[model samples]
Target: MSAQLDRESSENLLSDSRFFFEKIWLNVSLYLAFKIRSVNAPFWVEDTMASSLKPL
Candidate 1:
């Protein structure tokens, strides 16, 4: 009985660890994507501004 409980507890711990790792990975991916988008935004805005000014 004790051995069975130990196995169950270990399995639960592993499952929890997997869930935590997945969450961390998702957060990192989102952060990187946000950073890339922010970095590109100013360049896009500048390009649009330059094109608009060119016709004047």
Candidate 2:
């Protein structure tokens, strides 16, 4: 019973960490996109990045 609980907890931890990293990645991507736009990056470049990040 204890072993089963441990396994479940570990699984939860793994999923939580994965979620945390994904959130961080999304934030970083958005920040970069904003910077690019502020710098007057080309229309296609911003468009491509926006499209690519959309699926994530």
Candidate 3:
């Protein structure tokens, strides 16, 4: 029982970290796309980020 609980806890931690990691990246991407405007970035970066920004 303790081993199962430990496994579940570790899995939860892994999942939570992944969730936060993705959330942070999305926020960073959005910020670069709009806030700072990623002016010096490559055209593809701006284009892709711009398209993705519409859904949010």
Candidate 4:
């Protein structure tokens, strides 16, 4: 009985830690993607602006 309870508690702790790490990973990936997009956005905007300004 006590052993079973201990096993259940340990499993729960493992799952909780796994969930925490996954959440952190997700946040990190999202942040990196946003940073990459922001970094590229200015070049893209500049190209569009320059092309638009030219007479066809």
Candidate 5:
């Protein structure tokens, strides 16, 4: 019985850690994506404007 409890506790701990890591990874990915978009936004606008203004 004691061994069973220990196994269950360890499994719970592993699951909790996995959930924590997944949350952190998601937050980091979102942050990086937002940063990239913000960094590229101005260049995107300039490119669009330049293309629109170009004479065909």
Candidate 6:
């Protein structure tokens, strides 16, 4: 009984650690994507403006 409980506890700890690492990775990826989008926003706006100014 105690051995089973210990095994269960260890499994839970491993699962929790995996979940924590996955969450951290997701957050970092989202942050990097946001940063890239922000950096490109100005260039996109400029391109749109130039396209709109072109004679149709």
What would the TM-scores of all predictions be? 0.71, 0.87, 0.68, 0.67, 0.69, 0.66
lDDT winner among the candidates? 2
The candidate 2 region of ten consecutive residues with least summed lDDT is 47-56
On TM-score, the candidate that comes out on top is 2
Per-residue C-alpha lDDT of model 5 across residues 1-56, encoded as one tens digit per residue: 99999999999999999999988976776666566566766777656645643642
Model 6 lDDT, full chain set: 0.73
Q: List the residue pairs that clash in candidate 5.
A: none
Off by over 4 Å in 1: 41-56
lDDT of each: 0.74, 0.93, 0.82, 0.73, 0.73, 0.73
Model 6 misses residue 27 by how many Å? 0.4
lDDT by residue for model 1 over 6-54, one digit each (tens)? Answer: 9999999999999999889767766665665667667776566456446
1-56: candidate 4 lDDT, tens digit per residue? 99999999999999999999988976776666566566766777656544643542
* Ten residues in sequence with the least summed lDDT for candidate 5: 47-56
- Looking at model 2, the pairs that clash are none
Model 6: how far is 7 from its true place, Å? 0.7
Candidate 2 or 3, higher TM-score?
A: 2
- Per-candidate alpha-carbon RMSD to the true structure: 12.2, 1.3, 3.2, 11.8, 11.4, 11.5
Name the better of 1 and 6 by TM-score: 1
Q: Ranking under TM-score, best-scoring first?
A: 2, 1, 5, 3, 4, 6
Model 3, 1-56: lDDT tens digits are 99999999999999999999999998888776775454576777777877888877
